[model samples]
Target: MAQWFTKWIGWVRVIAFFGLLFGLIIRIGDPQPLETLRNASFDFYHQSKPRELTQLPVAIIDVDDTSIEEIGQWPWPRTRVADMVQLATAQGAVAIAFDIVFSEPDRLSPAQIAQDNPDIPPTLLSKLTALPDNDQVLADAFAKSRVIVGQTTVRTIAGNREEKREMAKVAHALIGPSPLPYLLAFPDIVQNLPALEANAAGRGIFNALPDPDGVYRRLPLVMSVQGQIRLGLTPELLRVATGGDPFAVRTNEAGLEGIVLARQLIPTAHDGTVWPYLTPSSRSRYVSAADLLKGRVPQGRLAGHLVLVGTSAIGLEDFRATPLGVAMAGVEVHAQVLENIMAKTLLVRPNYTIAIELVTTFILCTLVIIFAPSLSARLLISLSVVLLAGYVGTSYYLFVGKRVLLDPSFPVLATATAIILISTVNYLREERQRREIRSAFGQYVSPDLVDQLTQDRGTLSLGGESRELTLLFSDVRGFTAIAEEFRDDPEALTMLMNEFLTILSRAIMDQKGTIDKFMGDAVMAFWNAPLDNPDHARAACRAALKMIEDVHAFNAKRRREAARRRKARAGQKRKSAPARRKIHRIKVGIGINTGQCVVGNMGSDMRFDYTALGDPVNVASRLEGQSRYYGASIILGEATARALAETFAIMELDVVRVVGKAVPETIFALFGDETLARAPLFAALCATNSAMLQAYRDRQWDQAESQLAEVSALLDKLKLNMADYVEMYSGRIADLRIAPPPGDWDGVFASTSK
Candidate 1:
């Protein structure tokens, strides 16, 4: 009966926990983070699926760089714009839209020049004013064709903006609750010149606001200005091209359902915005304005098409960011919107999407809670991954097949959290005995050893014991310089350091070594401690070599990245290539020592840590610090080198007495594996180096100097940079030449500090 009650209470707690999580997600809906996830998911869908190949019946008349160069600069005489419009109309265009706004009167108009110079004679001024006004000439061309003039909505000024009021020509008929309260609204309107706007068939706002991330992913179909709802330029052009049909906008309590035209229904969000599916930019979608005027454009391309006149010239400053590329013309944004509408391939995130997500989260969480308690941790994790994959797959399918924007992050997150919570509960219940063991040994041993202890708790105890262990110490070189690189961004520095340390630690663990602890940018680890391995020395050596290989690969990648960045900056001519190509490489020095050491918990009574302590451990640490002095990445004590002499290519470095130690120790550096050691050049150098060391120790100064010279020449021939090793021998010889050592002198260098 007690077990039954406990199980019932456990079920209650699980349900309550999931219920609270579900409720929180529903209340918050899709916050910025969730929205960002949704956007990324949609972008993935966009990239994976083949874009619609049905060429949009729309064409953009671009004032591209070639057009601007050939036809002179922008604000080109109003007469020239009129000529392009006339040519487009002659090519049988169904409707023409001006993405360019004639907000101010033409500056070069005769009447404006006359007003600028008050000294002009009255007769001349009368003749100048009498000449046909350029604005009127453009109006005459507009009067002859089905042209939709673009306008803009602006923020409210300090005073009354009555003078800037311009009504959009499209009529809006509403059904159900009005969506104006939810629509993005502006206070004033910037319209084209009165003569030009009055003569056009229709006018609408040409506003294309980007998403929070600065990508043009959606098009606002309807916006409000000073309590008045209006259609945007593309919608207005569609309406005018369809014979000025009135649009009936459907709405419910949430906001908007869609807009109904004469022959098609366009779906939208609550605020009457539509997500556009963009394709890669195509040169075929554009016809240069100059080509249109010069009759160079193909005849059938513009016929019966809705033409949007805009510029792709870089100097125009009319570019927008898109998911597909760095920059796209703003006019192409409108063209894609119209294309999606006509193709009936519009993407929509309706008001009920949140409800659907909530249901998914609730159902998934319940399923996890029901099955998790009976399963082991491995199976539970597997089940959780499968459930997550299913949710994401379903969400992606809905997006690809149905054009629905459903967020999978919340559902997946909720399920994962539930699995974790229930799994923790199971752990607590099933591992009661192991929990007691962990409570005692967790702080002193690694998790692996702790588990082993649980299996056989007799092998481990709280006492000091001596074992043959290989201790490794690794530290970053030039860490201060690396830190200074990000002095202003400490968080970034922390992330970089953590990433590097993780890779290094992984390298060590990959060789079956146990990490004892991390000290700043350094890692201390040991082998053959908790578990007896006869090859611990070889494993430590391999781990050190692997660390060096990993750092080299990392530096190569950084250098390549830096080169690409520099090339990009150089192409822009903003700075010199050398100035932008500063690459900072991260380097590490590792040292390994093999000997018998006391491997057990050591510290104060209040707190103790599992570590290795002995002369060999101290030697390993000193060698790591000495590696930079020798200009080598890995330096191992003589014992470690002897253990791996048959496997690794080791070179003798020096015999030195480190600080606080009276005994001299021999250190060696690694070159490569056995294949490198078998090379003839390496064999010869090693033979000559050994002879040189023997001669120097025997006080044969002339012989020692001659052998050292031979070693230097061989190193130069092999293109090896072992200058530090050569410098040590040269300094020793020079000192002996000045003041020879006594006959008892040994070939050992003494170091005063670590």
Candidate 2:
């Protein structure tokens, strides 16, 4: 009877504990702790899986540092601003939204200048005063183009309450509760000049109200100003772009549900706001406003693109802190919001998210309390982890799969606190055993290896077995010249090499290849080890192609920088210093081979690393060294080429016997993969090249020379440079003609060096 009573008391205590935690979390609301956790959740999601490029045709016309340098300073003449509007409209821009506010008349207008100077002649002053006003010119441009002027909702002021607004209509109340009371409200509005505002197609409030922590996460889609609902800049632009129409607000008993604009339903919180998924800032999204004004922007750039005009100059103070990065351009915020809306990838956290979180917390905490007192230490720990994992998995499922957000951290935290409180004594007693285990293994292995050992100790072994793997070796061509350029600066050399390695390594890893090691400017990697990949050969080939593409992109960027520097120097009156030595046609040679190899932990048992060894590895290295001689960026051994023949565009180079191997092997150059193979020109070249190779191998000197001549002529007509290969083949044909080969010749070339 006493035991039953004690158990009942324990159940009562558990219920009371749960109630306490629940009340605490609910009372805290969006306080510092919960806000911090929410921000952390956002950061984790953003850092782990950021949004890709949006399909929306939205762009920003940034008045950046370069634009400022060329077009003088900020608050550029209103006529100039008008010219920008005209240019965008001329280029077929559907709509133009100003992130800038034209709240006052233009000070640079001729009338304003005439009024400022009284000493001018009366006739000249009268003419200047009679000239068209700059503000009026800008207003006329706005009237001609599809434009949306910006406004700001500020704290209630004395005179602005009576001001009229073109407010949004609450079309249909789909369910019981309305969202007006929950929305952010303000009494006053900072509007544009009457001339401009009257001419614009629409108006929107550009209110960048950050969260309590000053992080701009959610953008208010609709807000109440002076008891009148208004749309945000993003939605307003869309409305203008697709015929002007008022949006309908949908609601349920919980409050706001979403906003329906035409046929599209945009999910929003109870407060009529949306959580926008941000991507990194892109220069591609921006065209210089100055460029538009000067008519220097490329044609069709503004065509069918939603252009937002704003400034990114640092002193403009139009920057906002976001999860993507701090001091991000404010214009990008609206641009991404528009992008998410159009792409239908906007993040939403409905009112029910909180209710679901509270219920989950209560259930999880109760389970932890019930299970903590009855299990062994290890089982308890495992159970706790399982519960935590389940909670997190559910949360991520909702986030990634269901496109909903549910807070798992609060519940998991509460559960952890409950378990820790209940198991403190037991945990203390077992700490010594865990410490001993750590001492035995911590010093000898990496943290990842240690984790693997703890999960399953059976994997600990010294010897390795053979596996069929795809091996890759890449080396920088003309690396000595590159080193010479950086000889005076070792730190710069180190940084450059690190960046190059990182780019190549990333290309390999992105294709799921494991890097074996870095040998100076070269890197060796393998696929289908540590993790099995059926597409290992294809992945290695793709990685080599990607590495080449990366190098080309790097060289193009450098060339642009060099051009900019040269231009800057040319404009200077003083004699400029000699231009820095530049690297042109920066190239890398990649070799790939597929065959059997030994792969596992290598080196002494006390200190070892995962690596591969065998004949295939040696051959892959040798082929990489030979890529330069073949005048190809990528070379593959026979096995790899055979595996990928139908997938990649292959050009058979030669059959060669390396120094150690007596058996000659066929090798080929990889031009491109499936995409390139589909090209008509590439296919034609491949067919012709194959015929030429056959004639050369058959010892038909006259036929081979004729085909080679045709190939060279075809290459010239196609503007393709394969001169080195053509020259090498020509020399081979000449030498063979002078000294005929033995009748038993198998057409094999012996290479004495690796």
Candidate 3:
């Protein structure tokens, strides 16, 4: 009845857990703002770099207050403006990008039609009037050099046009692009601009900027006009600089929606708005109109650089608000477009956003269900923080690598759920466990061990043991020598060593062993105590074999990599020193053995440790240290080899009779268990070693030597030197003949080194 009740409660918890996950998914809402923030953040990260100017040929001719005052009024004559274009080309300006629009003919200028020509000869007046307007005059100048002109789009409201043509244009340009982009006092405005767009290097539309929050953070790739999208400045500048035809722009309601750059997918959210990345310190890229008329600036400053003409003229009232604050000139915005193109730092969002959110929701609630309530709030919070940072950091990396923005909403919800669920569970479980767990385990165990004991209600105790356990020790080979030779930064060295140990631990865990702790370059761990995998000998041997296999692969990779380095060095201009690249290489040794001893917990009365206490554990540790001398990765005792015989493939190495031992014990290498029963390499290795091992065991010195030679020859012939370890055995054979074994000849090799 009790078991049935417990089962029922477990089912209820599972249902409740799933219910929470579903609820989280429903509450996640749309991640628009979060997605927007992701784009802005990634864009800001990109745009924060130093704005290095490009070498694309572009010159900005400004119509400033000085030009207005020195050259008389804002509306200059078409002929005078035409002369400026001719002058710029004469000065060797490759491209002239105008920041103004010429929609009407110049009737006020003396060179143009006279204002009083109302009664002049109809043919003569028509000739004078049709001779040229600012557009024609500019066209004449543009013919001398590459010219790109900027125009503002005006929007006109439809349906209510009869009521308010005046006020409607304001809302029209704001809501959508106006017909001004295509309007001209001519028979065909499309053909004329198409010709102009053809004559000049490129033309672009300058439009609405993202308001106050300083978001949008990147300019749109294109802007739409009357169902026809025009290229924005950066891309247009690029297209012109690279000599490509003008790209057609198409807009959706989202504004300046997207572009197909090369073969990639660059998504845009704005229909026609400019996404400006906020500069940290400086103001807009404003070049004074006064400086342009009198060449006061350096020739190369604007020479071949795509210069955007915008007003930072104070109180022009173009500024509104930004993350850094407002007072921004509208013209500086276009300069940003130039910067974005040079860096290719465009922010984009993921195509499948909902799927990402659902995954985050499911994983978060499931974790809460699995863990007990007593888990620390601090621990849960730290884990949640790691998850959030990982999510955001991954998003940032992907944004930089793929130009794809990630949904940040899932991370936010997951972080929130982690904190709430863990906090709630901890509160509930602690109350339930406090009374029941103590009463259950208190009779057999003391007050302290009760906590560490969580297997069952009346089962174990908390941390307070002093029992001795076998402490198997393993370490990488040649580390001391390697450390002595390596001259990299101390922090980097530590990180590399730590990474290697982490790899080692994973292999250890694969064998069902519990890691006690790590010390700088060494690892100390045990088995059978923490979670009680009683077949620890089998587990430890399996782990040791895995380590050896991993090492072989690592060494082969290093050899190939070293070859690459040599080749790269040969290609360098000067061979002063080799360039450093990241590579991980190392050798490892393991020692493990099993025996019956004081097997219990060991720690302070208040905080003892649970481990085994016996001389066998010490012998195993000492054997690990002996690995270097024997030219072996691991050396295990007779008992461990027997225990692992059913699963592991072993190589019988010499036994060890250390101080205080009653007799020498046989040692063997645990190559692999049933898992690697039929690997060709393993089979080949076993087949080769069997012949040489049999000869050596018979003590036929010459025969054994010949067999060893044959083995090496066969391995060399196969060209399969996976480990190439027989050479070490050959050296051992040579040594053994010189120093004939004593009468006992107990194969044990006592290790006396640290």
Candidate 4:
């Protein structure tokens, strides 16, 4: 269970890293939460340090409450408006723009009054009709001055008055693809009266679009109205003020870049909108229309200044929310737009800023994922704080120094989330590793070793590491024939095999060995893994001897039980005879080898085992197989024998090459422990065995036979069974006598089977 979690920990991190990046990509669509965060940051920037009103090139001719009271309400006669226009032109104003649209003819006009009142005398009506039309008078005044009339876009036309609507005349020099697809479109426009629109030098739309929070931060400089492109009131005012020929709209595949007027470029957002860095509403920027008309305005106030005429009366409902958290007159917004542009203080969020923000966020989040697991909690928190501060600091600096808007909220949030998730995964992985260590090694190793493994987890590299390990492989000899005794009762066979394996496994665990796995009747184990054991070779040899001794005890107990069962069956009645069952003695061969190997968890990510892999492990299995051929209970490779040369009674078996190996390995057979090694009889037996092997290698068949008999006699004296060893050489010597070995024979016997 721990292995399963351990393998997926890395996957979890990868998934989280890319998952956060995908979320950042989704944020590019500007979901509500992310947009709110970004907008709040931008709002805070403006609120903290609004644009300062340095030079007032733009002035508002506000029709304030005082003006409304002084001038007798709105919708005043066109003659009165014409008089104000004439006065503004006489004051040397460069351009006068109306934020209010004169969409209908003045009802106070003399001709309209005449038409409304039919009861008047025919001669009086004729005299009134002979007087100049009020709209015509306003048109004459407009023609005499540089005036820009206002228009507004609507979603739908109220009635079938489209034929009477006048479109603004704008010359556009496009540089790339058409911007119609990228602009805010409206089906119709509320145009000024034909006379006022035709006489004006320029006409533009006065629509101030608000953000989602209903705050006017950015205003469109260009828009699509009735399938035609038209300039905003402020941009048109600049055009007339500079006398620029045509607007050079720069664009690319990514929507609008900027618009050029009089060779001066004005950068805009993708939708051709410009963010007006607004100042606090100041009374100094406004002059009452009553004051202007009454000759109360200062002399130079209107000189060289572009004036915007609009109503600020509360009854007009022209107020808008600004980023400063205050409601401002809509006309004042236009005046501020012109002021910002003319003063070169407009805030710009370039199109590439989004791409830059996304890339930065991804990189930051990736860094968090990569480092969060390794760093301490305190260090991670400090780093996160630094990173967040850096983002906000850079954004604030750009906003204050460069007048550029870049939001840091999303990056901060994303990086923090990555850190949290990756740290959590790391924590869980460590916990799992601890559980795995305790669960896997609790019974096999000592408590101190388990504690060491748990405390120093870096040593438990599941990916693998090369180490010198003493590997042991053991299998039941002739297990197929043994199993035939219980073929009709498989449950009994399972019980017998479980008991037999338990004894062997306990022997290995007693010496702090790791059980790699079991292959039916075979058991594979290794030492000097997961924890260091300098005496691993000696420990493995001891385990092998212990397993053989335990098996012999198990056989004695089984024989006693079988004999007791037979006595009970014989005493039963003849008509109720018990079923007869064959009993087999359990014998095993163990092989031990010491060499360099890679030991760790090995398998697929989903399922893996802590085991060792190398040629040494395979050689151990082949040595165990050769034990049966030599009639020995245990066998050891040259490395293991060399380590315990004097510690145990070991005899050289042969110099034979195992399957899959080109080099011959010197093999040894285990007889007993140190007590037997010091025994005089064992020393004599070893001398005889060495002489027999020497004579066999020298091709002296007669002397080899005589020495083999002496070796058998010593084995009988020691009460040991090794007839198969004597018979194997006897057959080999006979074969060599019949067909002598080749001249190049080096006394090395290469095994043909595993």
Top candidate on lDDT is 4
Segments of candidate 2 deviating more than 4 angstroms: 5-30, 157-178, 425-754
1 or 4, which is superior by lDDT?
4
Per-residue C-alpha lDDT of model 3 across residues 88-144, encoded as one tens digit per residue: 555555455555555555566433444566677777776766655555656766676
Per-candidate TM equals: 0.76, 0.56, 0.46, 0.55
Cα lDDT tens digits for candidate 4, 704-744: 99999999999999988899998999999999999999998
Q: Note the Cα lDDT for every prediction shown.
A: 0.83, 0.82, 0.57, 0.88
TM-score of 4: 0.55
lDDT, residue 467, model 1 = 94
* lDDT at position 215, candidate 4: 85
Q: Give the C-alpha miss distance for residue 128 in model 1, angstroms.
A: 12
Please give the RMSD to the true structure for each candidate, in Å: 6.6, 12.5, 18.3, 33.6
Looking at candidate 1, the ten consecutive residues that score lowest on lDDT are: 573-582
Per TM-score, what order, best first?
1, 2, 4, 3
The reply for model 1, stretches above 4 Å from the true place, is: 1-148, 155-159, 171-185, 199-202, 208-218, 240-257, 260-262, 278-333, 349-394, 406-464, 480-499, 574-581, 584-587, 605-608
lDDT of 1 by residue, 1-754 (tens): 9999777658646565657576665547656776676676677777677356577689999999878878987978898999998999988899999898998899878898898988999999999989988889999999999999998877875237646544644566888888888888887778898888889998878897777888887878888876788888888889989998788888888888888876677888888888887777778789999898888988778898998988888778899987664578999888888888888888878778887887787777777777677777788888778878988898888888898878877777677777777777777776896687687787888978867755875434456789999999999988998888877779978987887888898899998998999999999999997778899999998888888888888789778877778676665444333433235788888888999999887777677778888988999999988888887788989999998866787888778888878999999888778887888888898889889988988888899999999988988887767787788788888998899887777878788767
Residue 739 shift from truth in candidate 4, angstroms:
99
TM-score of 3: 0.46
